[model samples]
Target: MAAPAAKQQGFYDCRDAWARTIEELAENDPRIVAVVNDSVGSSKLGGFQKKFPDRLVNVGIAEQNMVGVGAGLANGGRIPFVSAASCFLTGRALEQVKADIAYAGFNVKLVGQSSGVAYGELGPTHHSIEDFAWLRPLSNIKVVVPADSWETAEAVKWAAAYEGPVYIRLSRMPVPDLVVENRKFQPGKAETVRKGDDVTIIACGTMVHLAVQAAVELEAEGISARVLNMATISPLDEAAISAAASETGAIVTVEEANIHGGLGGAVAEHTSANLPVPIERMGFPGFVPTGSVEWLFDHFGLTATGIARSARKAIGRKRG
Candidate 1:
């Protein structure tokens, strides 16, 4: 393992981008509407509420009803973005999400705000580590986890335009913007942030920048680690995974959610079936202890240094 890179200078909460992008889209599209479970402030939709008071629907702490209402709104030919905390939105209203939105094949954009451990000290009940697992099996729902502010905005814009069920996972955790040349938001396609041959680190959401930093640290030690931003968990880019597995021969999957049925599990399932490779999945094992967001990240080895360590282990497991 190599030393972590210098501390990031500035960090951005992707929720801001989500809010701004949706508001901009709403300005031109009259059908655009927002449905929340009293999370206008938390979802960073205060400005949006002020701009389109009538367009903002507050269901008052009813996650199930909120999702049902979003489905109804969609049936009425309105593009309703159902926003709420990831935990309650997915856990509380999973049936609605499965039947009303996904199974029904409604044109509703489900914006899961404060996803993963963004709720931090609020404990496991509030932590949304199982959201990916809950939604991934719902084949009709396209699950997207944006890596940064730019990606966040792009995913929102794309979801609004695409007519179908989509889940845009956003985090309150701050992260630096990735420095990818000619960056474009092509959902379900892995964006190569750094090219390497020794090992590949596939990550999404807040873990993407950390994975890039890990690749830099690995580079210092003559370890070429490829970093891929796998923003879309569902409808995964199988081609990228196959290339990384066959070319690199080793892989380390990192995500803010649980390893099972999340990004890591998705990758492992694909590779194990198509192309076998040594893989190390980095994420919460199960329910985590109470702590701040930063502490939890470090404790769970979700940091750049930890990711680099995992990458080395994966490389060591590679067989000739």
Candidate 2:
């Protein structure tokens, strides 16, 4: 059996990548502005504020008003990147997102920093696990979760130029580089990380690397598992999901979100209609426990070992 996939030697924070990309994009496009809710530090936009003082609009802890300001900026022909904590950004400003941004088709880039359980120590109140569930149902809004720093930078660049509303979910947690530095990011495409036959593991954001590691572990136990990075949650890679169902025979989905309405739910919706297959979804099952991020992930079965376990169970269901 092959050994586990080689782990990356260093770590990188996606927020740093987002900040750098935003600054670079601002250099080229004068229309790029950042709207924040008194979260300049948390969003890692200090440098941006210094460089583009007038461009950084801090709305002073008003999440809903921040979204309104962003929409207004868009109305004035400026591209606004609304950056703030995921919980407040999505939960407090959801109506603005739905009506002003999505319904109006404003070209606003909603940047949810420190998403998922990246704030695990702060408990469920700080967790943005429900953002995906909340945003995916809205029309005219593209939901994206970048797996690592490279993907985060690329996604931010893409969102800057895209002509419609986009929500980019990012984490403060450090993750190994996933995509190549210069690989062009496609909004609705899924990247195949590893190929196998017995089962398929579809994951997004931070779960992508873990899914790849899980495939390696399953290989050691004589299970062939295909791993796919389903980065774009809203415009899901339907063709890829369909092919995985037809070829792999079984499917397991991993996410750092609720199982009901995130990556797992999206995959289930696709496969159920296009091609029925045995499936297992792994994510936070309920209100999460209070602990460090690492502890919470292990506690909720969001680790590589746990993913492999789910993959094996999915294979068993396929055989049964």
Candidate 3:
């Protein structure tokens, strides 16, 4: 993946992809509707509202009620997207999500907009470092954190068509296109952006771009680092993970979420028991730090420089 000599003129925010998917899906399938907690604007749905005013259901600031309404809508034959900030959507209405959505298997799409540290200056209370940890344990639900605009758009299409509960964390951070244009997003499968035998860099969400950059850096240093964008967190791509471990011998897992019970924990559990290769997990150490999202990411060591350094350390350890 070569960095553009000049930053490309066409970088799509993942939110654009979300709104695009909603508009396209709604055009064909009238069942596709959006339900939010008075966050239609912040969640980037003004266009959606203009297109489908009646279909846009705003349940005010009450998170729990917002989700319950979504579940009811699903039961009534409408495909509802329960969209909200990740901190509020997953944290505030966890019970509603568990009982009304997951347990009931409602075809409600939970779009977590502005997730992770995208809340930036709002502090830890607004950060969503624990979403993966909270959602991964739930049964009968799919958790996805797409790596880039292509993955994000495809994931949205997949969730809209699939007849089950799903949670998608849409980051506020801008992303370049990954995978070919409109690539097929396979649920429960990891996409190997780069293949190598030295080490495997397993990452998802915003950290995936950093992982790919790290692999490029490693390549320049004569290290063969494979890059796996593990988009599906729950019902994780364990098979791809095991293959990376058995084939590559060393692995580095990265995420914008907490290192515990997110991408790292899932891969560690699989690799430690089955493949048992050396692993270095690069992510938040449980506490959600206070600062701008960029500052917190740098502070927590998830920038491209940080991931590269961690990959170097992991490769060294594996050689020993």
Candidate 1 lDDT, 261-320, residue by residue in tens: 999999999999999999999999899998888889999999999999999999999887
lDDT of 2 by residue, 1-320 (tens): 11212334677788999999999999999999999999999999999999999999999999999999999999999999999998999999999999989998898999998888887667888888998889989968999999988889999999998899999999877788764334567889988888889999999998999888898898988988998888899988899999999999999999989998888999999899889999999998767977787888898888999999888888888755
**Per-residue lDDT for 1-320 in model 3, tens only?**
11112334655568888888788999999998999988987788999999899999998999999999999999999999889988999999999999999999999999998887777777778888899989988968999999887788889999999999999999878777765433568998998888899999999988888888888888898988999988999898889988998898889999888888888999999888888988999888876655776678888888888888888888788755
- As a whole number from 0 to 100, the lDDT of residue 56 in candidate 2 is 98
User: In candidate 1, what residue range of length 10 has the lowest lDDT sum?
Assistant: 1-10
- Residue 297 displacement in candidate 1 (angstroms): 0.6
Give the alpha-carbon lDDT of every model. Answer: 0.93, 0.89, 0.86
In angstroms, the error of model 2 at 83 is 0.2
lDDT of 2 at 13: 80
Which candidate has the highest TM-score of all?
A: 1
Using lDDT as the measure, the top candidate is: 1
Alpha carbon lDDT of residue 188, candidate 2? Answer: 93
Deviation (Å) of 196 in candidate 2: 1.4
lDDT minimum window of 10 residues, candidate 3: 1-10
Model 2 lDDT, residue 63, Cα: 93
Q: Is candidate 1 or 2 superior in TM-score? A: 1
**lDDT at residue 171 of model 2 (Cα atoms):** 83
